[model samples]
Target: MQDILYNLMSTEFENPWKTIRSRPIYDNPWIAVREEDVLKPNGAPGIYGVVSFKNKAIGIVPVDSEGYTYLVGQFRYTLNEYSWEIPEGGGPMNEAPLETAKRELEEETGLHAATWSELGRIHTSNSVTDEEGFLFLATDLTPGPSNPEDTEQLIIKRVSLKDAVAMVMRGEITDSLSIAGLLKAFMIVSSY
Candidate 1:
């Protein structure tokens, strides 16, 4: 343990700096790219893939009163297929991460929670993406009326925790933060 701590302290956290072209390379709805040269940890210089989005959003692990996990079904535009995923929406720009999670949970599934706790924040796609995702756990839920947007055709469903994990493993659910939040929630609840 001491050696591990010493090794952790000895590792450099700084990345070598490089010159940038000082101009916007590409601008689009999802992200804007700026031309930047990066010096690698080994001192090699190259162009880096940088993406700037508005911000990441929040995902909630909604456990119902019956101890079942609430999941949402919707077609992902990118994936072009219907899949099971935890409800997630809004971002830091619209509201607080926790507030966003609450809003999204109510908007998509119409389940309101009396208690909420943030598990933590996740950095989604850190390799070439600049999105920070928030993870939340919701409990003491009561059913409410859903108000999905015109573009959304959401179907709320409750699943056993065991089956939910199995769905993810079977590739039936493919959302990133959903999988992460569900796994975390399952671990926490299962410990007791």
Candidate 2:
């Protein structure tokens, strides 16, 4: 396997935010954004690009003690469709990624884990948007009551490890973050 960071070098960026244009991503009023950004790549200079996002969030593959995985179904305003995603949640503002993961896991799946291992973070379309989402593994879980937001109408469901992977292959679960965590977990679990 090729190392992803084999040739990577980075520097702290400041004042790289410049907006050429921005538009609402959805008609519902709270999600999505068509954003233009000016960034200093490799500390050379500033370049501008535009991209769209359905808001930023943390996604979790909530695993129970029984080795089951939980997913949540909710209507996504940007896609204007319902999706079955990993337990996903976000912050009030400027919240840590781990904090969001813990909160989202409990709210979406009604399950809290005694341990969480952060798989990593993913930025699917980082060219123009300023969003980086974290992915996590939830284990040692105990079930409780879901606490979805007032505007949220969510359904929680569980699938065995085998079935979860099958759902991804069947396009039944397409959320990128969830998919990433599952694939990573699969790589580790299947090796055993």
Candidate 3:
């Protein structure tokens, strides 16, 4: 695995597909859709539809000194199901991801932290979307009143980091960002 990753990182490659034409399919404040006509690497013509996001995504796991972390529960319209995830939201393209993480953490959980560390970065649904996400670990938390956005009706739950990892393993938390963030946090916290 290390060899493969090393080769991948050390190699320089160019895009194999040549774009022949492109057109917009949809547009909104949050997302824009475009369809492109391309010449494939195999020299065949193809069309690809891509969803572009206007903002980067940020997910935060606020862990107090007691090893307790917070989760936000809400109904996800696209999935038509309720999801339990770490405090997450969109950061404007021009904004810093850390600032976005701080704002989202406070807005969704009413928690402020004195220390922050980035867990990892992920691309959510790479095949269909160009949405990028950053995960954070927040410690030394102080709680206040939550100020969720108008579009959000959220339920906040506090759980041990271990329990949160179990929820991810049990498939109770399926959001990609949450699952990845929690699992990474579990590994980092367990080492200490």
- Highest TM-score model number: 3
Q: Can you tell me which runs of candidate 2 are displaced by over 4 Å?
A: 1-56
lDDT digits (tens) for residues 1-192 of candidate 1: 999999999998865566645467898666787767767667777877777777566899998766699899988898878978899875656667888888889999889999998888887788877888999989999999999889889888899877898888998888889889888888887886
Q: What is the lDDT of residue 137 in candidate 3?
A: 96
Instruction: Superpose all Cα atoms of candidate 1 onto the true structure and report the RMSD in Å to 1 decimal.
Output: 2.4
Q: What's the TM-score of every candidate structure? A: 0.88, 0.73, 0.96
Worst-scoring 10-residue span by lDDT in model 1: 14-23
Candidate 2: residue pairs that collide? none
lDDT of 2: 0.73
> What digit string (tens of lDDT, one per residue) describes model 3 on residues 1-192?
999999999999999999999999999999999999999999899999999999999999888899999999999999999999999999999998999999999999999999999998999899999999999999999989999999999999999999999999899999999998999988899899
lDDT of 3 at 94: 97
Query: Which 10 residues in a row give candidate 3 its minimum summed lDDT?
Result: 181-190
